[model samples]
Structures are given as C-alpha cells and as structure tokens.
Target: MLEIRQIPVLEDNYVYLVHEPVEKLTAVVDPAVTDEVMSAAASAGWTITHILNTHHHFDHVGGNEEIRDKTGCTIVGPRADRDRIPGIEIELGDGDLFQFGAATARVFDVPGHTKGHIAYWFEADKALFCGDTLFALGCGRMFEGTPGQFWPSLKKLRDLPDETRVFCAHEYTQANARFALSIDPDNVELTMRSKEIDALRAHGIPTVPSVLAAEKATNPFLRADQPEIAAQLGMEGRDPIDIFAEIRHRKDNF
Candidate 1:
C-alpha cells in the first residue's frame, strides 16, 4: 500500500509525500518550499527518493533543486515544459508509465492552467495527483491554453473511475463551492456540497482529495455539457466548450 501525507504550505498550496513502505521509497509532489517538505519527510521517517512535478510553475517546483541536491532524488516532470523544470532528469508525456518503488502511475498531459501541466494517476491506489488542473469544485484557470485545449484536458480526467481520490494542489474548495452555487443553483448535490464545504472551512478543516464522483455530480465546470447548466447560463443548445468558456470567464471575474 502507498502511504500519502499532505503538508500545507505557502498560504494555500499543498505538498504531498507519496511513500511505498515496502521499499521505503518516497516521492514528494510539487514541493513549494524546502523546509516544510524536508521536515515532514524526516518526521515520517521516509527518505525522499523522487520529485514528481506536474508543471513548471515556481510554486510547484520551487524546492526541486534543493530537495534533489539534499536527497539525490530523481526529478520527473512533463517533457513539454522541460526547459522550465528545475533538475528534471526524466521527462514524461501522456500515457507514459512511471514507477515508484512497487507502485506505478499513469501520466496524463492535462494542460489548461499551463500548457505543459500533467497529472499522475496511480490506478491501483485510486489516487490522482493533479496539480492545478482539476480542483474539488472547479478547474484551473486557462492561463496558457485555450478553451479548446482546456476542455479536452478536463474530459480526460472526468472519465476516471468515480472512486478516484483527487489530490489537487491547493485548498480552494470553499471559494470554488461559492462559484459553483452561482452557476448551478438548482443542483441538489451542489447545494449540499456547498453547505458541507462551508461547514468544513468554518472549522479550519482541509477540503482536498475530493472524490471524483462528487466532483462530476456537483462541479459546474464538469457539468457544462448538461442541458440544465446550459439553460441556466441562458445558452441553451450551445456547445459544451462554449458554455465552459462562459463559466470560466464568469469565475475569472468573480
């Protein structure tokens, strides 16, 4: 079994440490800072052996060099953004299989927040380490990719098993639930989820690693193709991508 630990850092970002206990091999996902990640690994008695980066964003790869230098870990990341990834030793693409001790992860090129962004899905573990691509109640903003490119990227993730646990890189669920309610006010699931999120946030609880089933049922971004959502946007019969773009536009300004 793979043991995963979440370490919150830099206001809202989350750094994950994935460990395979048999071999005691551990991989740190998107370490934004060095000290917290290093300390967490030390406290857990896990030695970091790999750095799995999802994109080239500074927040995601900021500690790559330091961590790798300290532990002599192999750095893996998207081949599309190789130039930007610090200490990238293994450049991976879509459909590529990456090995971490006894576990394996299927790499997905899910670009939207960034053109070279990727996600790691450990099928057996039912875990998806998606950095800034798919969030709990929303998707990442289209920073470098267009709606055309972004929608397909989301579709790939949307097709995953319902039981998959989404380990997104930020604590944005509370704010995302608010935006979801505005667009999908009538959805019973969304309403319930929004209230749940509010309660969780009120108590200072972390609301990440949401189930894929809940996200598909309640996230407005994932429901753009639903007729009800299109009707709510006053864009009945429009292309899903167009509806998605509109929702993203509204959220951008919200």
Candidate 2:
C-alpha cells in the first residue's frame, strides 16, 4: 500500500511525500523547501529515492538540487523543460511509466500553468500529483500556455474515475470555493463545501487532495457547462469554454 503525507512549505505550497513501506522506498513531489522534505522523510523513516518535478517553476523545483545534493536522490522532471529544471537526471514525458513502490505512475502532459507542466497519475492507488493544473475548486491561471491547452488538459483529469484523489500544490480551496459560489450561489454542494473549507482553514488544516467527485460537483471551472453556472453568470446558452474563460478572468481580479 502507498503511504502519503503532505508537508507544508512556504506559505501555501504542499510538498507530497509518497512512500511504500514494503519496499522501503520514497518519492517526493514538488519540494519547495529542502528542510521540509528532509523532515518528512525522517518522520516516515524512508530514504527518498526520487524527486519528481511537475514543472520548472521555482516554487516547485527550488529545492531540487539542495535535496538531491543532501540525499543523492535522482531528480525527475518533464523532458521538455531541461533548461529550466534543476538536477534532472531522468527526463520524463507523456506516457512515461515510473514505479513508486509496488504501484506505478503514468505521466500526463497537462500544459496551461506552464508549457511543460505534467501530472503524475498513480492509477492503482487513485492519486494524482497535478501541480498547478487542477485545484480543489479552481484551475491554475494560464501562464505560458493557452486556455485551449488548459481546457483539454483539465478534461483529461476529469475523465479519470470520480474517486481519484487529487493532490495539488497549493492551499487555495477556500478562495476558490468563494469564486465558485459567485458563479453559482444556488449550488448546494459548493455552499456546503465552502463552509467546510472555511472551518478547515480556521483550524490550520490542509485542504488538498480533494476527491475528483467533489470537484466535479462544486468546482466552477469543471462545471462551466452546467446551466446553473451559465445562468448565474449571465451567460445563459454560452459555450462552456467561454464560460470557463470568463470565470477564470473574474477570479484573476478577485
């Protein structure tokens, strides 16, 4: 079985430590801080064998070399981002398969937040390390890619089983939920979820790895096609993609 833990770093970044005790192996995703990664590995009593970078963003790969220099772990990153990523010994691409323990991860090319951004899908375990592509109640801002690229990229994850556990890199659930509610205040799922997320934030708890089912039901970006969202946003009968773009634009200012 896979043991997963979230190591909070910086203000809102979440570095994931995934381990399989039976194999005594560990892998970390998006290490923003070396000390946090080291502490998590020590807590789990597993030697980290690999550091996975979803993109070349500094907040995601800032500690790559430091961690690798300290632990001698292999750095794996998107093959397309060789110039930007640090210490990448293994260059990965879409369709790449990597072993975590007894389980496997399939690489997904999810560009939008970054041109070379990728997500790791552990199908058997139903876990995803999606960087900034998909969030709990929102999607990442388009930084280096087009919305055309982003919508399809998100659709790829949306196509996954509803039970898949989505591990994103930030703690923006409460704000995202509020933005979602603006698009559909009558959505009971979003209404209830917003309160739950507020409580989680107040208690200093993590609001990540939300179930795909919950996101599908309440996330406005994922529900752009729903009549409730379109009507509430004064965009009745609009194309879903346009509605999605408008919502993202509004959130950028919000």
Candidate 3:
C-alpha cells in the first residue's frame, strides 16, 4: 500500500510525498522547494528515495537538484523532454510504468501545460500526480502547446476513474472556482464547490487533491465538450477543440 502526503510551499505550490511503507520508499513529486520537502520528510522519519518531476518548469523542478544532492534520490522525469529536466536518472514516456516497492504508477503524456508534461497515475492507490496540466476547476494555460494539443491531453485525464484522487500542484482552486462559476453559472455542483473552496482558502487550508468525479462535474476545462458549456460560450455543434480554445482564450484574459 502507498501513503500520500501533501506539502504546501512557495505560497501556492503543493509538493506531494508518495510513500510505500513496506519498503520505506518515498518519492517526492514536483518539489518546488527542497527545504519544505526535506523538513516534512524529516518530521515523518521518511527519506526521499525518488524525485519525480512532472515537467521541466522551474516551479516543478526547482528543488530537483537540491533534494537529490541532499538525499541522493534518483530523479525521474519525462523522456520526451529529458534535456530540460534536472538530474533525470529515469526518463519515462507514455504507457511506461515506474515502480517502487510493490507500487507502480503509469505515466500518461499530458502535454499542454508544457509540451513534454506528463502525469503519474497509481491505479492501485488511486493517486494522480498531475503537475500543471489539470487543475481543480481550470486547466493550465497553453504555454508550450496549442489548444488542440491541450484538449486531448485533458481528455486522457478526464477518462481516469472518477474515484481517482487528483493531486494537482497548485492552490488555484478558489480562483478557478470563480472562473468556473462565470462560465458555468447554473452548475449547482460548481456553485457549492466554490463556496467550499472559499471557506477552505479563507482559513488558509489547502484546496487540492480534488476527486476526479468532482473535477468532471465542476471543472470547466473538463466540461468543454458538454452541451451546457458549449451553449454558454455561444458555440453549438462546433468542434470541441474550437470551444476549448475559446474557453482558454477567455480564461487567459479572465
């Protein structure tokens, strides 16, 4: 079995520690800051044996070298963009499996947030470590990929089991919820979720690790194909990618 813990740092970023107790193995996912990761591990009497990078973005891999240097942990990242990630010892591609102890996470090529972005899904544990590709109520901006490139990537994630717990890398839920409400005003589920997010953020609590089911219902990026969302965007019977592009453009300015 695997145990997952959230380590919030850098004002809004979240770094996760996926641990396998049977072998005392831990993988720190997207370590934005090394000190925060190390301090959390030390507090729990855990040693980071692996450093998992979801992308080559500075926030995601900023602490890669530091943590690896401090704990001698092996760095694993996307094979397609190995040249960008820091200290990549194992370069994985879509459909590749990364194993530690008895736990294995399947890698999915989820580009859009970044051209080489990837996500780790541990089906056995139902934990998804998606860096910046998929967020709570919104998706990442098309920084490196086009709208079409980003749309299919989101579908790959949306198709995951609804029960899967999505561990995203940022605390943008409140803002995302607000944006979702603007676009999906009649979505009761989203309305309620936005209230909950407001309360959580008001109290300085983390609003991450959102269930896939909840995201499917409330996240606008994932709902781009829905008739309701398309109608609101004045796009009926249009290609999903075009609707998705319009949503992204609105969000970019939102």
TM accuracy, model 1: 0.99
TM-scores, each model vs. reference: 0.99, 0.96, 0.98
Candidate 2, 156-247: lDDT as tens digits: 88988999999999999998988887777888878999999999999998889899999999988887778988888899998877887888
What are the clashing pairs of model 2?
Answer: none
The clash numbers for all candidates, in the given order, read 0, 0, 0
RMSD of each: 0.7, 1.3, 0.8
Candidate 1 local lDDT, residue 227: 94
Candidate 3 TM-score to native: 0.98
Highest lDDT model number = 1
Give the runs in model 2 whose Cα sits over 4 Å from its true position. Answer: none
> Relative to the true structure, how large is the alpha-carbon lDDT of every model?
0.94, 0.89, 0.92
Clashing pairs in 3: none
Local error of candidate 3 at residue 207 (angstroms):
1.0
- Candidate 3's displacement at residue 152, Å, is 0.6
